[model samples]
Target: MTMLEGVTTRPGGRRPGATRTRVDILAAAQRSFAEHGYVLTTIRGVARAAGVDPALVLQFFGSKDGLFDAALRDDPPVRALVTLAGEGDPSDLGPRLAARYLELWEDPHTGPRMLAVVRAATAAPSASAMVTAFMTDEVMLPLARAIGADQAELRAALTGAYLFGVASARYVLGVAPLAALDREAAVTYVAPVVQHHLTGDLTPP
Candidate 1:
């Protein structure tokens, strides 16, 4: 018998609750990735947490990498960061962006997911690409364009690289002194560099 045999089916012979099932799977994946990080989070574990078959998780997300991308994409912080990059004074963009980025990492609701994404990116090429695209396309590029900056793309790249480095060192690698710094202190240290990237001259001196 086929997998659908003896099972309730919807129109077009599709399984019932397709939307809800996908949502459930994604929610479970988010939790698992947040708690366990990427290397430790398994498709089977997420499927079991969501109360769905392992095949169903694969059918929905295709693989662990896809699930990680979806979970990161679905996260609210991604959109929030994009929005934040364009808000506030252009002059104060550095401190503003740094504060918000650090706040997301410090927040209980968002930190683990951000941590998961960073950790995954280090281990997976696909995850790394997703992060690069998100930081460039979603956040920095638009912000640079909004400021009418010359070499907008380069400026955006510099800004994203700096922020990503700071985040990885503090949150992911737990680098000494940096990781030990409290949020405001971290922001204070980071804001000037971010400001320079956003508004300072890029020409080699």
Candidate 2:
């Protein structure tokens, strides 16, 4: 189960009579993201799986990069994660957000896949676009809202830099000192930054 999501959900697949002609291609890309990890997956393989003309996939998504971007929007962590945040106090949002974010990263199945995608995205245009799109659409939107801030878009992007950086260093790259620290240690240090981002600093006792 992802963060706050039930595991029973499955892709509805293409709508009937849709024949957008690119449906198969999209499905193929989805599987590729899961099986081969983003780095090893290829547009050619996706084309082959779809059993359509390889050029069709290219024409539809514009590039492997374009397909990757679409994938994030299509299948994202937002629904569940947001569900977890439902009806919660805005001021105390930091730890909940941090906990959910960390939970996703720590998940065994999702973690490896996510890690693979992140690694693959580092150099791949398609993968990079996918990563950027997910962060913008899912994580950033609610993060801005939880804080009751205007310019949610900007706040979201700023929060992205902080969160993604920590995820990469601690979970992905496994920085020595940070890796050694416990989750509580992380929550204590990390939550304050999230707190500031969501609810800006003000004079206090």
Leading candidate by lDDT = 1
Report the CA-based lDDT of candidate 1 relative to the real structure: 0.81
For model 1 the local lDDT of residue 24 reads 76
As a whole number from 0 to 100, the lDDT of residue 175 in candidate 1 is: 99
Q: Write the per-residue lDDT of candidate 1 for residues 38-98, one digit (tens) a residue.
A: 8888998887777778898899889998888788778547467656655777788888889
1-205: candidate 2 lDDT, tens digit per residue: 3221222222334433335556666766766776676776687777766666667678788876777776656655543555544558777777877777777777865675567567766767756766876776776777577556766776677667787788889987899898778887887778778767666643354
Q: What shift in Å separates residue 12 of candidate 2 from its native position after superposition?
A: 22
Quote the lDDT for 94 in model 2: 75
TM-score of each: 0.85, 0.73
Instruction: For each candidate in the order shown, give its overall lDDT on alpha carbons.
Output: 0.81, 0.68
Q: After superposition, how far is residue 106 of candidate 2 from its true place, in Å?
A: 1.7
Stretches of model 2 off by over 4 angstroms after superposition: 1-24, 34-39, 125-130, 182-184, 202-205
Weakest ten-residue segment in model 2 by summed lDDT: 1-10
Shift of residue 185 alpha carbon in model 1, Å: 1.9
Instruction: Give the range where candidate 1 is weakest over 10 consecutive residues by summed lDDT.
Output: 2-11
